[model samples]
Target: MVIFGVVQIIFSQIPDLHEVWWLSIVAAVMSFSYSSIGLGLGIGKAVEKHADYGSLKGVGIRDVFHDADKTWSVFQALGNIAFAYSFSMVLIEIQDTIKSPPAENKTMKKATTIGVAVTTLFYLSVGCVGYAAFGDNAPGNLLTGFGFYNPFWLVDIANICIVIHLVGAYQVFSQPLFAFVEEWCSSKWRNSNFINKQYTVKLPGYGPLELTLFRLLWRTCFVIFTTLVSMILPFFNDIMGILGALAFFPLTVYFPIQMYIVQHKVKPWSRKWLILHLLSTVCFIVSLAALVGSVAGVVARLQQNYKPFKTTY
Candidate 1:
Protein backbone atom coordinates (compact mmCIF):
# COMPACT_ATOMS: atom_id res chain seq x y z
CA MET A 1 0.00 0.00 0.00
CA VAL A 2 2.93 2.34 0.76
CA ILE A 3 4.32 1.49 -2.65
CA PHE A 4 0.97 2.32 -4.23
CA GLY A 5 0.90 5.56 -2.22
CA VAL A 6 4.27 6.59 -3.62
CA VAL A 7 3.18 5.65 -7.12
CA GLN A 8 -0.06 7.56 -6.60
CA ILE A 9 1.93 10.62 -5.52
CA ILE A 10 4.26 10.50 -8.50
CA PHE A 11 1.52 9.61 -10.93
CA SER A 12 -0.76 12.39 -9.67
CA GLN A 13 1.96 14.90 -10.54
CA ILE A 14 2.45 13.38 -13.95
CA PRO A 15 0.26 14.48 -16.87
CA ASP A 16 -0.45 10.87 -17.83
CA LEU A 17 -1.90 9.45 -14.62
CA HIS A 18 -3.50 6.54 -16.53
CA GLU A 19 -0.09 5.36 -17.74
CA VAL A 20 1.20 5.52 -14.19
CA TRP A 21 -1.74 3.44 -13.00
CA TRP A 22 -0.89 0.75 -15.57
CA LEU A 23 2.78 0.81 -14.61
CA SER A 24 1.84 0.40 -10.97
CA ILE A 25 -0.39 -2.54 -11.88
CA VAL A 26 2.46 -4.21 -13.79
CA ALA A 27 4.83 -3.78 -10.86
CA ALA A 28 2.20 -5.25 -8.52
CA VAL A 29 1.75 -8.31 -10.77
CA MET A 30 5.49 -8.97 -10.69
CA SER A 31 5.86 -8.70 -6.90
CA PHE A 32 2.62 -10.32 -5.61
CA SER A 33 3.88 -13.91 -5.81
CA TYR A 34 7.08 -13.29 -3.86
CA SER A 35 5.37 -11.24 -1.14
CA SER A 36 2.32 -13.41 -0.30
CA ILE A 37 3.29 -17.00 -1.09
CA GLY A 38 4.96 -17.39 2.30
CA LEU A 39 1.64 -16.74 4.08
CA GLY A 40 -0.24 -19.65 2.49
CA LEU A 41 2.74 -21.99 2.52
CA GLY A 42 3.22 -21.16 6.19
CA ILE A 43 -0.39 -22.10 6.92
CA GLY A 44 -0.01 -25.36 5.02
CA LYS A 45 3.07 -26.23 7.08
CA ALA A 46 1.27 -25.43 10.32
CA VAL A 47 -1.68 -27.57 9.33
CA GLU A 48 0.60 -30.45 8.42
CA LYS A 49 2.11 -30.35 11.92
CA HIS A 50 -1.26 -30.03 13.63
CA ALA A 51 -4.91 -31.01 12.82
CA ASP A 52 -4.24 -34.68 13.37
CA TYR A 53 -7.40 -36.81 13.03
CA GLY A 54 -6.44 -38.92 16.05
CA SER A 55 -5.39 -42.09 14.28
CA LEU A 56 -3.76 -40.15 11.44
CA LYS A 57 -1.20 -38.50 13.67
CA GLY A 58 1.69 -40.72 12.63
CA VAL A 59 0.41 -41.56 9.17
CA GLY A 60 2.23 -41.56 5.84
CA ILE A 61 2.91 -38.62 3.45
CA ARG A 62 -0.69 -38.99 2.26
CA ASP A 63 -1.82 -36.83 5.19
CA VAL A 64 -0.08 -33.82 3.73
CA PHE A 65 -1.79 -34.33 0.37
CA HIS A 66 -5.18 -34.79 2.03
CA ASP A 67 -4.80 -31.60 4.06
CA ALA A 68 -3.63 -29.72 0.99
CA ASP A 69 -6.65 -30.88 -0.97
CA LYS A 70 -8.97 -29.64 1.76
CA THR A 71 -7.16 -26.31 1.97
CA TRP A 72 -7.26 -25.84 -1.80
CA SER A 73 -11.00 -26.42 -1.88
CA VAL A 74 -11.61 -23.86 0.84
CA PHE A 75 -9.28 -21.39 -0.88
CA GLN A 76 -11.20 -21.70 -4.14
CA ALA A 77 -14.57 -20.93 -2.50
CA LEU A 78 -13.17 -18.00 -0.48
CA GLY A 79 -11.92 -16.26 -3.65
CA ASN A 80 -8.48 -15.93 -2.12
CA ILE A 81 -6.79 -16.58 -5.44
CA ALA A 82 -8.14 -13.37 -6.99
CA PHE A 83 -7.79 -11.25 -3.87
CA ALA A 84 -4.22 -12.32 -3.09
CA TYR A 85 -3.05 -11.64 -6.62
CA SER A 86 -4.54 -8.14 -6.64
CA PHE A 87 -3.34 -7.20 -3.16
CA SER A 88 0.23 -8.24 -4.03
CA MET A 89 0.42 -5.69 -6.86
CA VAL A 90 -1.18 -2.96 -4.76
CA LEU A 91 1.27 -3.69 -1.93
CA ILE A 92 4.29 -3.12 -4.16
CA GLU A 93 2.90 0.11 -5.58
CA ILE A 94 2.17 1.28 -2.02
CA GLN A 95 5.72 0.43 -0.93
CA ASP A 96 7.15 2.39 -3.82
CA THR A 97 4.93 5.29 -2.82
CA ILE A 98 6.21 5.36 0.74
CA LYS A 99 9.91 4.64 0.13
CA SER A 100 12.40 7.44 0.58
CA PRO A 101 14.22 8.70 -2.44
CA PRO A 102 18.04 8.28 -2.70
CA ALA A 103 19.98 10.25 -0.04
CA GLU A 104 21.65 12.32 -2.72
CA ASN A 105 18.28 13.44 -4.08
CA LYS A 106 17.33 15.60 -1.12
CA THR A 107 15.07 17.84 -3.20
CA MET A 108 13.10 14.88 -4.52
CA LYS A 109 12.82 13.43 -1.03
CA LYS A 110 11.40 16.65 0.38
CA ALA A 111 9.00 16.97 -2.55
CA THR A 112 7.96 13.34 -2.20
CA THR A 113 7.25 13.82 1.48
CA ILE A 114 5.19 16.91 0.79
CA GLY A 115 3.30 15.10 -1.92
CA VAL A 116 2.54 12.13 0.29
CA ALA A 117 1.51 14.38 3.13
CA VAL A 118 -0.93 16.22 0.92
CA THR A 119 -2.34 12.99 -0.46
CA THR A 120 -2.73 11.63 3.05
CA LEU A 121 -4.57 14.76 4.09
CA PHE A 122 -6.97 14.34 1.21
CA TYR A 123 -7.58 10.75 2.18
CA LEU A 124 -8.13 11.73 5.80
CA SER A 125 -10.58 14.45 4.90
CA VAL A 126 -12.62 12.03 2.84
CA GLY A 127 -12.43 9.51 5.64
CA CYS A 128 -13.71 12.04 8.12
CA VAL A 129 -16.70 12.93 5.98
CA GLY A 130 -17.33 9.29 5.27
CA TYR A 131 -17.19 8.33 8.91
CA ALA A 132 -19.41 11.22 9.90
CA ALA A 133 -22.00 10.28 7.31
CA PHE A 134 -21.91 6.55 7.94
CA GLY A 135 -20.26 6.49 11.35
CA ASP A 136 -18.18 3.38 12.06
CA ASN A 137 -19.98 1.50 9.34
CA ALA A 138 -18.49 3.53 6.50
CA PRO A 139 -17.78 1.64 3.31
CA GLY A 140 -14.21 0.41 2.79
CA ASN A 141 -13.73 2.99 0.06
CA LEU A 142 -14.76 6.55 0.86
CA LEU A 143 -16.14 6.99 -2.63
CA THR A 144 -19.25 5.10 -1.73
CA GLY A 145 -19.89 7.60 1.00
CA PHE A 146 -19.27 10.38 -1.48
CA GLY A 147 -21.95 8.89 -3.67
CA PHE A 148 -24.29 8.74 -0.72
CA TYR A 149 -23.50 12.38 -0.12
CA ASN A 150 -24.71 12.98 -3.70
CA PRO A 151 -21.39 14.20 -5.07
CA PHE A 152 -21.21 13.11 -8.72
CA TRP A 153 -17.67 14.31 -9.48
CA LEU A 154 -16.23 12.55 -6.46
CA VAL A 155 -18.06 9.42 -7.51
CA ASP A 156 -16.31 9.48 -10.89
CA ILE A 157 -12.87 9.87 -9.33
CA ALA A 158 -13.68 7.09 -6.89
CA ASN A 159 -14.68 4.86 -9.78
CA ILE A 160 -11.29 5.29 -11.42
CA CYS A 161 -9.44 4.48 -8.18
CA ILE A 162 -11.73 1.52 -7.59
CA VAL A 163 -10.67 -0.04 -10.88
CA ILE A 164 -6.98 0.39 -10.10
CA HIS A 165 -7.42 -0.87 -6.55
CA LEU A 166 -9.37 -3.93 -7.70
CA VAL A 167 -6.75 -4.82 -10.30
CA GLY A 168 -4.01 -4.54 -7.67
CA ALA A 169 -6.01 -6.68 -5.22
CA TYR A 170 -6.60 -9.34 -7.87
CA GLN A 171 -2.87 -9.57 -8.48
CA VAL A 172 -2.18 -9.84 -4.75
CA PHE A 173 -4.68 -12.67 -4.23
CA SER A 174 -3.61 -14.63 -7.32
CA GLN A 175 -0.03 -14.96 -6.05
CA PRO A 176 -0.80 -17.50 -3.35
CA LEU A 177 -2.89 -19.61 -5.71
CA PHE A 178 -0.17 -19.59 -8.34
CA ALA A 179 2.44 -20.47 -5.75
CA PHE A 180 0.31 -23.28 -4.33
CA VAL A 181 -0.34 -24.72 -7.77
CA GLU A 182 3.32 -24.61 -8.73
CA GLU A 183 4.44 -26.19 -5.48
CA TRP A 184 1.73 -28.85 -5.30
CA CYS A 185 2.04 -29.96 -8.93
CA SER A 186 5.84 -30.08 -8.83
CA SER A 187 5.85 -31.96 -5.50
CA LYS A 188 3.27 -34.49 -6.59
CA TRP A 189 4.88 -35.15 -9.98
CA ARG A 190 8.52 -35.28 -8.85
CA ASN A 191 7.88 -37.07 -5.51
CA SER A 192 9.68 -34.16 -3.77
CA ASN A 193 8.80 -30.74 -2.46
CA PHE A 194 8.61 -27.93 -5.02
CA ILE A 195 11.66 -26.02 -3.82
CA ASN A 196 13.82 -29.16 -4.02
CA LYS A 197 12.87 -29.93 -7.63
CA GLN A 198 15.78 -28.98 -9.89
CA TYR A 199 14.81 -27.09 -13.02
CA THR A 200 15.00 -29.32 -16.10
CA VAL A 201 14.76 -28.36 -19.79
CA LYS A 202 14.29 -31.76 -21.48
CA LEU A 203 11.65 -30.43 -23.88
CA PRO A 204 9.94 -32.95 -26.15
CA GLY A 205 8.55 -32.12 -29.61
CA TYR A 206 5.05 -31.51 -28.11
CA GLY A 207 6.30 -28.73 -25.80
CA PRO A 208 5.84 -25.79 -28.20
CA LEU A 209 2.26 -26.74 -29.03
CA GLU A 210 1.39 -27.17 -25.36
CA LEU A 211 2.93 -23.84 -24.35
CA THR A 212 1.27 -22.00 -27.23
CA LEU A 213 -2.10 -23.55 -26.47
CA PHE A 214 -1.87 -22.63 -22.81
CA ARG A 215 -1.00 -19.02 -23.59
CA LEU A 216 -3.80 -18.75 -26.13
CA LEU A 217 -6.37 -20.21 -23.73
CA TRP A 218 -5.26 -18.03 -20.81
CA ARG A 219 -5.40 -14.87 -22.88
CA THR A 220 -8.79 -15.78 -24.28
CA CYS A 221 -10.22 -16.36 -20.84
CA PHE A 222 -8.77 -13.10 -19.56
CA VAL A 223 -10.32 -11.18 -22.41
CA ILE A 224 -13.70 -12.72 -21.78
CA PHE A 225 -13.49 -11.97 -18.08
CA THR A 226 -12.46 -8.39 -18.75
CA THR A 227 -15.42 -7.94 -21.05
CA LEU A 228 -17.81 -9.29 -18.46
CA VAL A 229 -16.40 -6.98 -15.78
CA SER A 230 -16.63 -3.99 -18.08
CA MET A 231 -20.26 -4.77 -18.72
CA ILE A 232 -20.92 -4.75 -14.98
CA LEU A 233 -18.85 -1.68 -14.16
CA PRO A 234 -21.94 0.35 -13.32
CA PHE A 235 -22.46 -1.57 -10.08
CA PHE A 236 -18.80 -2.19 -9.34
CA ASN A 237 -18.71 0.33 -6.50
CA ASP A 238 -21.50 -1.35 -4.52
CA ILE A 239 -20.09 -4.83 -5.10
CA MET A 240 -16.65 -3.74 -3.96
CA GLY A 241 -18.04 -1.84 -0.99
CA ILE A 242 -19.78 -4.95 0.34
CA LEU A 243 -16.81 -7.19 -0.36
CA GLY A 244 -14.32 -4.77 1.20
CA ALA A 245 -16.31 -4.66 4.41
CA LEU A 246 -16.94 -8.40 4.60
CA ALA A 247 -13.61 -9.88 3.51
CA PHE A 248 -10.93 -7.19 3.45
CA PHE A 249 -12.07 -5.35 6.55
CA PRO A 250 -12.28 -8.50 8.65
CA LEU A 251 -8.95 -9.88 7.53
CA THR A 252 -7.02 -6.64 7.49
CA VAL A 253 -8.39 -4.91 10.56
CA TYR A 254 -10.28 -7.34 12.77
CA PHE A 255 -8.10 -10.45 12.40
CA PRO A 256 -4.87 -8.60 13.09
CA ILE A 257 -6.26 -6.97 16.21
CA GLN A 258 -7.52 -10.30 17.52
CA MET A 259 -4.30 -12.05 16.56
CA TYR A 260 -2.15 -9.52 18.41
CA ILE A 261 -4.37 -9.75 21.46
CA VAL A 262 -3.91 -13.52 21.54
CA GLN A 263 -0.21 -13.46 20.59
CA HIS A 264 0.64 -11.10 23.44
CA LYS A 265 -1.44 -13.11 25.94
CA VAL A 266 -3.00 -9.97 27.24
CA LYS A 267 -4.68 -10.12 30.62
CA PRO A 268 -7.51 -7.90 31.87
CA TRP A 269 -5.01 -5.47 33.36
CA SER A 270 -2.98 -5.15 30.15
CA ARG A 271 -3.67 -1.85 28.43
CA LYS A 272 -2.56 -3.23 25.08
CA TRP A 273 -5.08 -6.00 25.10
CA LEU A 274 -7.85 -3.77 26.36
CA ILE A 275 -7.28 -1.28 23.57
CA LEU A 276 -6.97 -3.93 20.88
CA HIS A 277 -9.91 -5.89 22.17
CA LEU A 278 -12.07 -2.79 22.10
CA LEU A 279 -10.88 -2.01 18.60
CA SER A 280 -11.62 -5.54 17.45
CA THR A 281 -15.06 -5.38 18.99
CA VAL A 282 -15.84 -2.07 17.38
CA CYS A 283 -14.50 -3.20 14.02
CA PHE A 284 -16.55 -6.38 14.22
CA ILE A 285 -19.73 -4.42 14.76
CA VAL A 286 -18.83 -1.87 12.11
CA SER A 287 -18.03 -4.60 9.61
CA LEU A 288 -21.41 -6.18 10.14
CA ALA A 289 -23.19 -2.88 9.61
CA ALA A 290 -21.04 -1.99 6.64
CA LEU A 291 -21.92 -5.28 5.00
CA VAL A 292 -25.63 -4.73 5.52
CA GLY A 293 -25.54 -1.00 4.78
CA SER A 294 -23.61 -1.43 1.59
CA VAL A 295 -26.29 -3.81 0.43
CA ALA A 296 -28.95 -1.21 1.25
CA GLY A 297 -26.97 1.37 -0.69
CA VAL A 298 -26.91 -0.96 -3.67
CA VAL A 299 -30.62 -1.55 -3.53
CA ALA A 300 -31.23 2.17 -3.35
CA ARG A 301 -28.95 2.71 -6.31
CA LEU A 302 -30.84 0.16 -8.37
CA GLN A 303 -34.12 1.83 -7.49
CA GLN A 304 -32.80 5.22 -8.52
CA ASN A 305 -31.53 3.73 -11.75
CA TYR A 306 -34.79 2.05 -12.62
CA LYS A 307 -37.42 4.14 -10.90
CA PRO A 308 -41.10 4.02 -11.79
CA PHE A 309 -42.49 7.35 -12.97
CA LYS A 310 -45.88 8.81 -12.01
CA THR A 311 -47.71 11.34 -14.11
CA THR A 312 -48.55 14.41 -12.02
CA TYR A 313 -49.57 16.84 -14.77
Candidate 2:
Protein backbone atom coordinates (compact mmCIF):
# COMPACT_ATOMS: atom_id res chain seq x y z
CA MET A 1 0.00 0.00 0.00
CA VAL A 2 2.83 2.43 0.78
CA ILE A 3 4.52 1.70 -2.52
CA PHE A 4 1.23 2.17 -4.33
CA GLY A 5 0.65 5.47 -2.58
CA VAL A 6 4.01 6.73 -3.75
CA VAL A 7 3.31 5.54 -7.28
CA GLN A 8 -0.06 7.31 -7.18
CA ILE A 9 1.52 10.57 -6.06
CA ILE A 10 3.99 10.39 -8.94
CA PHE A 11 1.29 9.63 -11.51
CA SER A 12 -0.99 12.33 -10.18
CA GLN A 13 1.37 14.87 -11.70
CA ILE A 14 -0.27 14.11 -15.04
CA PRO A 15 -3.22 16.31 -14.00
CA ASP A 16 -5.68 14.91 -16.57
CA LEU A 17 -7.65 11.72 -16.10
CA HIS A 18 -8.20 11.35 -19.84
CA GLU A 19 -4.47 11.00 -20.41
CA VAL A 20 -4.33 8.12 -17.94
CA TRP A 21 -7.68 6.58 -18.87
CA TRP A 22 -6.07 3.37 -20.06
CA LEU A 23 -4.71 2.81 -16.54
CA SER A 24 -8.28 2.57 -15.29
CA ILE A 25 -9.08 -0.01 -17.96
CA VAL A 26 -6.05 -2.11 -17.08
CA ALA A 27 -6.87 -1.84 -13.39
CA ALA A 28 -10.45 -2.88 -14.02
CA VAL A 29 -9.36 -5.93 -15.96
CA MET A 30 -6.87 -6.94 -13.26
CA SER A 31 -9.45 -6.44 -10.51
CA PHE A 32 -12.05 -8.47 -12.39
CA SER A 33 -9.55 -11.25 -13.03
CA TYR A 34 -8.58 -11.34 -9.36
CA SER A 35 -12.18 -11.55 -8.21
CA SER A 36 -12.98 -14.20 -10.81
CA ILE A 37 -10.07 -16.31 -9.63
CA GLY A 38 -11.28 -16.05 -6.03
CA LEU A 39 -14.83 -17.04 -6.93
CA GLY A 40 -13.67 -19.93 -9.06
CA LEU A 41 -11.36 -21.30 -6.39
CA GLY A 42 -14.03 -20.94 -3.70
CA ILE A 43 -16.69 -22.70 -5.74
CA GLY A 44 -14.25 -25.38 -6.82
CA LYS A 45 -13.30 -26.09 -3.25
CA ALA A 46 -16.92 -26.31 -2.20
CA VAL A 47 -17.87 -28.57 -5.11
CA GLU A 48 -14.91 -30.86 -4.47
CA LYS A 49 -16.05 -31.31 -0.86
CA HIS A 50 -12.74 -30.12 0.50
CA ALA A 51 -12.29 -30.64 4.26
CA ASP A 52 -13.59 -27.12 4.82
CA TYR A 53 -16.81 -27.80 2.96
CA GLY A 54 -18.36 -29.63 5.93
CA SER A 55 -18.21 -26.39 7.93
CA LEU A 56 -20.36 -24.61 5.35
CA LYS A 57 -22.91 -27.42 4.86
CA GLY A 58 -25.56 -25.76 6.97
CA VAL A 59 -24.96 -22.21 5.78
CA GLY A 60 -27.97 -20.30 4.55
CA ILE A 61 -29.48 -16.83 4.37
CA ARG A 62 -29.79 -16.78 8.15
CA ASP A 63 -26.02 -16.98 8.38
CA VAL A 64 -25.79 -13.60 6.79
CA PHE A 65 -27.37 -11.96 9.83
CA HIS A 66 -25.21 -13.82 12.37
CA ASP A 67 -22.60 -11.55 13.99
CA ALA A 68 -20.51 -13.80 16.23
CA ASP A 69 -21.62 -11.99 19.41
CA LYS A 70 -20.65 -8.61 18.01
CA THR A 71 -23.92 -6.71 17.83
CA TRP A 72 -22.29 -3.63 16.26
CA SER A 73 -20.55 -5.63 13.53
CA VAL A 74 -23.58 -5.38 11.27
CA PHE A 75 -23.35 -1.62 11.29
CA GLN A 76 -19.66 -1.76 10.42
CA ALA A 77 -20.40 -4.18 7.59
CA LEU A 78 -23.07 -1.85 6.26
CA GLY A 79 -20.65 1.03 6.39
CA ASN A 80 -18.07 -0.94 4.38
CA ILE A 81 -20.67 -1.88 1.77
CA ALA A 82 -21.94 1.69 1.61
CA PHE A 83 -18.40 2.95 1.11
CA ALA A 84 -17.86 0.44 -1.69
CA TYR A 85 -20.85 1.89 -3.51
CA SER A 86 -20.07 5.53 -2.78
CA PHE A 87 -18.43 6.76 -5.99
CA SER A 88 -20.60 9.86 -5.93
CA MET A 89 -17.77 11.60 -4.10
CA VAL A 90 -15.68 11.51 -7.27
CA LEU A 91 -18.41 11.38 -9.94
CA ILE A 92 -18.24 15.02 -10.90
CA GLU A 93 -14.45 14.97 -11.05
CA ILE A 94 -14.61 11.98 -13.38
CA GLN A 95 -17.26 13.64 -15.54
CA ASP A 96 -15.12 16.71 -15.92
CA THR A 97 -12.74 14.56 -17.94
CA ILE A 98 -15.38 14.16 -20.64
CA LYS A 99 -15.33 16.50 -23.62
CA SER A 100 -17.81 19.40 -23.83
CA PRO A 101 -20.69 20.00 -24.50
CA PRO A 102 -20.17 17.67 -21.61
CA ALA A 103 -23.59 15.98 -21.43
CA GLU A 104 -21.96 15.09 -18.14
CA ASN A 105 -25.10 14.14 -16.28
CA LYS A 106 -26.29 11.72 -18.94
CA THR A 107 -22.86 10.22 -19.46
CA MET A 108 -22.23 9.89 -15.74
CA LYS A 109 -25.61 8.24 -15.14
CA LYS A 110 -24.97 5.62 -17.82
CA ALA A 111 -21.44 4.98 -16.62
CA THR A 112 -22.54 4.66 -12.99
CA THR A 113 -25.38 2.29 -13.84
CA ILE A 114 -23.08 -0.03 -15.76
CA GLY A 115 -20.31 0.15 -13.17
CA VAL A 116 -22.65 -0.62 -10.28
CA ALA A 117 -24.30 -3.51 -12.09
CA VAL A 118 -20.98 -5.16 -12.90
CA THR A 119 -19.53 -4.55 -9.43
CA THR A 120 -22.65 -5.95 -7.75
CA LEU A 121 -22.45 -9.15 -9.76
CA PHE A 122 -18.76 -9.63 -8.93
CA TYR A 123 -19.27 -8.93 -5.23
CA LEU A 124 -22.21 -11.34 -4.95
CA SER A 125 -20.38 -14.15 -6.71
CA VAL A 126 -17.25 -13.80 -4.57
CA GLY A 127 -19.14 -13.34 -1.31
CA CYS A 128 -21.49 -16.27 -1.80
CA VAL A 129 -18.92 -18.72 -3.10
CA GLY A 130 -16.36 -17.77 -0.44
CA TYR A 131 -18.87 -18.20 2.35
CA ALA A 132 -20.05 -21.49 0.90
CA ALA A 133 -16.49 -22.72 0.77
CA PHE A 134 -15.45 -21.75 4.29
CA GLY A 135 -18.65 -20.85 6.16
CA ASP A 136 -18.12 -18.58 9.18
CA ASN A 137 -14.39 -19.21 8.94
CA ALA A 138 -14.03 -17.51 5.58
CA PRO A 139 -10.96 -15.31 5.55
CA GLY A 140 -11.35 -11.57 5.27
CA ASN A 141 -9.28 -11.85 2.08
CA LEU A 142 -9.81 -15.00 0.05
CA LEU A 143 -6.28 -14.98 -1.35
CA THR A 144 -4.71 -14.93 2.10
CA GLY A 145 -6.70 -17.97 3.20
CA PHE A 146 -5.10 -20.03 0.43
CA GLY A 147 -2.01 -21.65 1.88
CA PHE A 148 1.29 -21.02 0.07
CA TYR A 149 1.86 -24.76 -0.48
CA ASN A 150 -1.38 -25.31 -2.44
CA PRO A 151 -1.80 -23.75 -5.87
CA PHE A 152 1.08 -21.45 -5.00
CA TRP A 153 1.52 -20.00 -8.50
CA LEU A 154 -2.16 -19.25 -8.89
CA VAL A 155 -2.26 -17.49 -5.55
CA ASP A 156 0.77 -15.45 -6.52
CA ILE A 157 -0.88 -14.43 -9.79
CA ALA A 158 -4.08 -13.37 -8.06
CA ASN A 159 -2.15 -11.35 -5.47
CA ILE A 160 -0.11 -9.66 -8.18
CA CYS A 161 -3.26 -8.69 -10.04
CA ILE A 162 -4.64 -7.19 -6.85
CA VAL A 163 -1.51 -5.12 -6.37
CA ILE A 164 -1.61 -3.85 -9.93
CA HIS A 165 -5.27 -2.93 -9.66
CA LEU A 166 -4.75 -1.13 -6.35
CA VAL A 167 -1.84 0.81 -7.81
CA GLY A 168 -4.12 2.37 -10.39
CA ALA A 169 -7.05 2.69 -8.02
CA TYR A 170 -4.92 4.56 -5.50
CA GLN A 171 -4.06 7.14 -8.14
CA VAL A 172 -7.69 7.47 -9.21
CA PHE A 173 -8.89 8.14 -5.67
CA SER A 174 -5.94 10.24 -4.48
CA GLN A 175 -5.94 12.66 -7.39
CA PRO A 176 -8.84 14.62 -5.99
CA LEU A 177 -7.18 15.03 -2.62
CA PHE A 178 -3.95 16.03 -4.37
CA ALA A 179 -5.79 18.63 -6.44
CA PHE A 180 -7.52 20.03 -3.37
CA VAL A 181 -4.26 20.47 -1.47
CA GLU A 182 -2.44 21.89 -4.47
CA GLU A 183 -5.14 24.46 -5.06
CA TRP A 184 -5.02 25.55 -1.46
CA CYS A 185 -1.23 25.83 -1.54
CA SER A 186 -1.31 27.81 -4.74
CA SER A 187 -3.82 30.18 -3.23
CA LYS A 188 -1.65 30.67 -0.17
CA TRP A 189 1.61 31.17 -2.07
CA ARG A 190 0.12 33.44 -4.71
CA ASN A 191 3.39 35.27 -5.32
CA SER A 192 5.43 32.10 -5.90
CA ASN A 193 6.42 31.41 -9.47
CA PHE A 194 5.37 27.79 -8.98
CA ILE A 195 1.79 28.94 -8.47
CA ASN A 196 1.95 31.09 -11.61
CA LYS A 197 2.70 28.04 -13.80
CA GLN A 198 6.08 29.54 -14.86
CA TYR A 199 8.20 27.64 -12.29
CA THR A 200 11.11 30.09 -12.26
CA VAL A 201 13.19 28.63 -9.43
CA LYS A 202 16.95 28.51 -10.17
CA LEU A 203 20.04 27.29 -8.29
CA PRO A 204 23.47 28.91 -8.40
CA GLY A 205 25.07 25.73 -9.75
CA TYR A 206 22.21 24.73 -12.06
CA GLY A 207 20.13 26.25 -14.85
CA PRO A 208 16.52 27.49 -14.34
CA LEU A 209 13.96 24.72 -14.04
CA GLU A 210 10.25 24.44 -14.90
CA LEU A 211 9.60 22.15 -11.94
CA THR A 212 7.29 23.29 -9.15
CA LEU A 213 9.36 22.53 -6.04
CA PHE A 214 6.58 23.32 -3.59
CA ARG A 215 4.09 21.15 -5.47
CA LEU A 216 6.50 18.25 -5.55
CA LEU A 217 7.45 18.70 -1.93
CA TRP A 218 3.88 18.89 -0.66
CA ARG A 219 2.68 15.90 -2.68
CA THR A 220 5.64 13.80 -1.56
CA CYS A 221 4.94 14.76 2.05
CA PHE A 222 1.29 13.81 1.69
CA VAL A 223 2.21 10.38 0.35
CA ILE A 224 4.73 9.85 3.16
CA PHE A 225 2.17 10.81 5.79
CA THR A 226 -0.40 8.37 4.41
CA THR A 227 2.22 5.66 4.15
CA LEU A 228 3.18 6.15 7.79
CA VAL A 229 -0.43 5.93 8.88
CA SER A 230 -0.95 2.74 6.88
CA MET A 231 2.14 1.23 8.46
CA ILE A 232 0.98 2.23 11.96
CA LEU A 233 -2.60 0.94 11.59
CA PRO A 234 -2.52 -1.86 9.09
CA PHE A 235 -5.83 -3.42 10.09
CA PHE A 236 -7.45 -3.31 6.66
CA ASN A 237 -11.01 -4.18 7.60
CA ASP A 238 -11.13 -1.92 10.62
CA ILE A 239 -9.72 1.01 8.67
CA MET A 240 -12.15 0.42 5.84
CA GLY A 241 -15.07 0.33 8.25
CA ILE A 242 -14.01 3.56 9.90
CA LEU A 243 -13.47 5.40 6.61
CA GLY A 244 -16.70 4.06 5.17
CA ALA A 245 -18.74 5.24 8.12
CA LEU A 246 -17.10 8.65 8.08
CA ALA A 247 -17.58 9.19 4.34
CA PHE A 248 -20.73 7.30 3.27
CA PHE A 249 -23.58 9.57 4.28
CA PRO A 250 -21.96 12.92 3.61
CA LEU A 251 -20.43 11.96 0.30
CA THR A 252 -22.76 9.29 -1.06
CA VAL A 253 -26.22 10.05 0.30
CA TYR A 254 -26.60 13.50 1.81
CA PHE A 255 -24.75 15.84 -0.52
CA PRO A 256 -26.12 14.44 -3.78
CA ILE A 257 -29.74 14.43 -2.61
CA GLN A 258 -29.41 17.84 -1.00
CA MET A 259 -27.93 19.26 -4.20
CA TYR A 260 -30.73 17.75 -6.29
CA ILE A 261 -33.44 19.06 -3.97
CA VAL A 262 -32.03 22.56 -4.14
CA GLN A 263 -31.45 22.46 -7.89
CA HIS A 264 -35.02 21.27 -8.58
CA LYS A 265 -36.51 23.81 -6.20
CA VAL A 266 -38.34 21.13 -4.25
CA LYS A 267 -40.59 22.87 -1.74
CA PRO A 268 -41.02 21.88 1.91
CA TRP A 269 -44.09 19.63 2.53
CA SER A 270 -43.95 18.56 -1.14
CA ARG A 271 -43.42 14.92 -2.09
CA LYS A 272 -39.89 15.38 -3.43
CA TRP A 273 -38.69 17.45 -0.50
CA LEU A 274 -40.25 15.13 2.05
CA ILE A 275 -38.90 12.00 0.37
CA LEU A 276 -35.42 13.42 -0.02
CA HIS A 277 -35.27 14.58 3.57
CA LEU A 278 -36.58 11.24 4.79
CA LEU A 279 -33.87 9.36 2.92
CA SER A 280 -31.21 11.75 4.19
CA THR A 281 -32.40 11.31 7.76
CA VAL A 282 -32.25 7.55 7.48
CA CYS A 283 -28.74 7.72 6.03
CA PHE A 284 -27.68 10.06 8.80
CA ILE A 285 -28.78 7.57 11.42
CA VAL A 286 -27.03 4.72 9.65
CA SER A 287 -23.83 6.77 9.39
CA LEU A 288 -23.90 7.57 13.08
CA ALA A 289 -24.40 3.94 14.03
CA ALA A 290 -21.59 2.86 11.72
CA LEU A 291 -19.27 5.45 13.20
CA VAL A 292 -19.96 4.28 16.72
CA GLY A 293 -19.52 0.65 15.73
CA SER A 294 -16.22 1.30 14.01
CA VAL A 295 -14.87 3.29 16.94
CA ALA A 296 -15.86 0.56 19.35
CA GLY A 297 -14.25 -2.09 17.20
CA VAL A 298 -10.99 -0.15 17.06
CA VAL A 299 -11.00 0.44 20.79
CA ALA A 300 -11.64 -3.22 21.50
CA ARG A 301 -8.82 -4.22 19.18
CA LEU A 302 -6.51 -1.79 20.92
CA GLN A 303 -7.49 -3.08 24.32
CA GLN A 304 -6.53 -6.57 23.18
CA ASN A 305 -3.10 -5.25 22.20
CA TYR A 306 -3.52 -6.35 18.61
CA LYS A 307 -0.21 -6.13 16.80
CA PRO A 308 0.12 -3.60 14.04
CA PHE A 309 1.65 -4.34 10.62
CA LYS A 310 0.39 -7.89 10.90
CA THR A 311 -2.17 -9.65 8.71
CA THR A 312 -5.30 -10.47 10.73
CA TYR A 313 -6.04 -13.57 8.71
For model 1, what is the error of residue 235's alpha carbon versus the real structure, in angstroms, after optimal superposition?
Answer: 1.4
The lDDT values for all models are 0.44, 0.74
**Judged by lDDT, which candidate is best?**
2
Output the TM-score of candidate 1: 0.40
**Candidate 1 lDDT (Cα, whole model)?**
0.44
Of the candidates shown, which would achieve the greatest TM-score relative to the real structure? 2
lDDT comparing candidate 2 with the true structure: 0.74
lDDT of 2 by residue, 67-178 (tens): 4425566666676677785567667788888775648778888889999999999888887787777776777688776774367888889999999897777777777776
Q: Report clash pairs, candidate 2.
A: none
Name the regions of candidate 2 deviating beyond 4 angstroms. Answer: 16-18, 51-69, 100-102, 148-150, 197-210, 307-313
The positional error of residue 175 in candidate 2, measured at the CA in angstroms, is: 0.8
